[model samples]
Target: MELTLVDLSVARGGVPVLAGVSLSLAPGQALVLRGPNGSGKTTLLRTIAGLQPALSGQVTGAEDRIAYAGHADGLKAMLSVRENLTFWAAVFGMRDVEQAMQAFALLPLADRLAGTLSAGQKRRLGLARLLVTGRPIWVLDEPTVSLDADAVALFAGAVRAHLAAGGMALIATHIDLGLDAAVLDVTPYRVALNGVGFGSSDEAFL
Candidate 1:
């Protein structure tokens, strides 16, 4: 499946964040969003995932076929890892919950409460929901946050495998994802007051 974001703009408390952003992602393609903090990368991902309202753009995709893993690691803290996975699986209508847990390497921590798991562990469990959902489009915000080296590699490999298998991904990350995906520097896409491009902080051309 393909997704497109056209003429996108976002604001927080009446302050402009992202403006005139447009992007297209197709199957077997991944795009990394790179920018410093407060650069609107996360906001763009959230808007595309339909989590936050888009102020003045269109997100066109198969709404039912999209999966999002945000920065916060959205998991039920009160439930065990297994329970959290099971709950998300049910929400996404997965056929086999055990397989999904095992895929994320959560079998050992399955019995432990999500609240008690380490930061890395929680991120893995949150990402594991995508395995269960089998969505075509993945919108991830800082997917590798708090992950150890091994977990980071695991997440990168999973994303690579997903793209290889004809899935689309929009990743907002500061670190390299180790995938042969294209880069969409949102920094340049930001408009400037005059035609001089003061808001474009992307250094690629410098």
Candidate 2:
């Protein structure tokens, strides 16, 4: 599968953020969006995931294959770790939680309440839900917050496994996710609203 964006324009809060962006991603490939904090990385990812509408232009090739994971973990506080994954799996029409449990190292926390896990542990459980969704295209926004070094490695391994299975991923992150992904700095596509639609700045993402 492949996702192609041609001259895509995206906005947040009814204001243009990213304008005239174009890119293409194929199976087994990953695209990383990098830019300053306010450079619309989240907006662009949401647009690609179909969570929000685009202002203009076209986004093609990605239909129902998108699985979006935003900044929030989206876990039920009272539910156990396994319960959360199983719930999402059922919602996404899957029955297997074994892979997801091992993917994020959630097996150790399987019986633990989501509310009891640390921030990093909760993040892992949240990410594990993606495996059960069975979607081919992953749209993630800052997926590694609060994760320790070991957990980050585990996350990277999961991504690589997904790619090996011919899945594509689009991630918007500050620090590295450890994937050898194509980096697209969105700084150039940002639209400034100083009563005008275009401008330039010197801030680059690290």
Predicted model with the maximum lDDT: 2
lDDT of 1: 0.79
Model 2 misplaced regions, further than 4 Å: 195-206
Output the worst ten-in-a-row residue range by lDDT, candidate 2. 197-206
lDDT string for model 1 (62-154, tens) is 488789887568888899988887787788777677766766688999799999998888889988888878798988887887888888888
Against the true structure, whose TM-score is highest? 2
Quote model 1's TM-score: 0.87
Indicate the residue-level lDDT of 38 in model 1: 60
Instruction: Assess the local accuracy of residue 181 in candidate 2 as a C-alpha lDDT between 0 and 100.
Output: 93
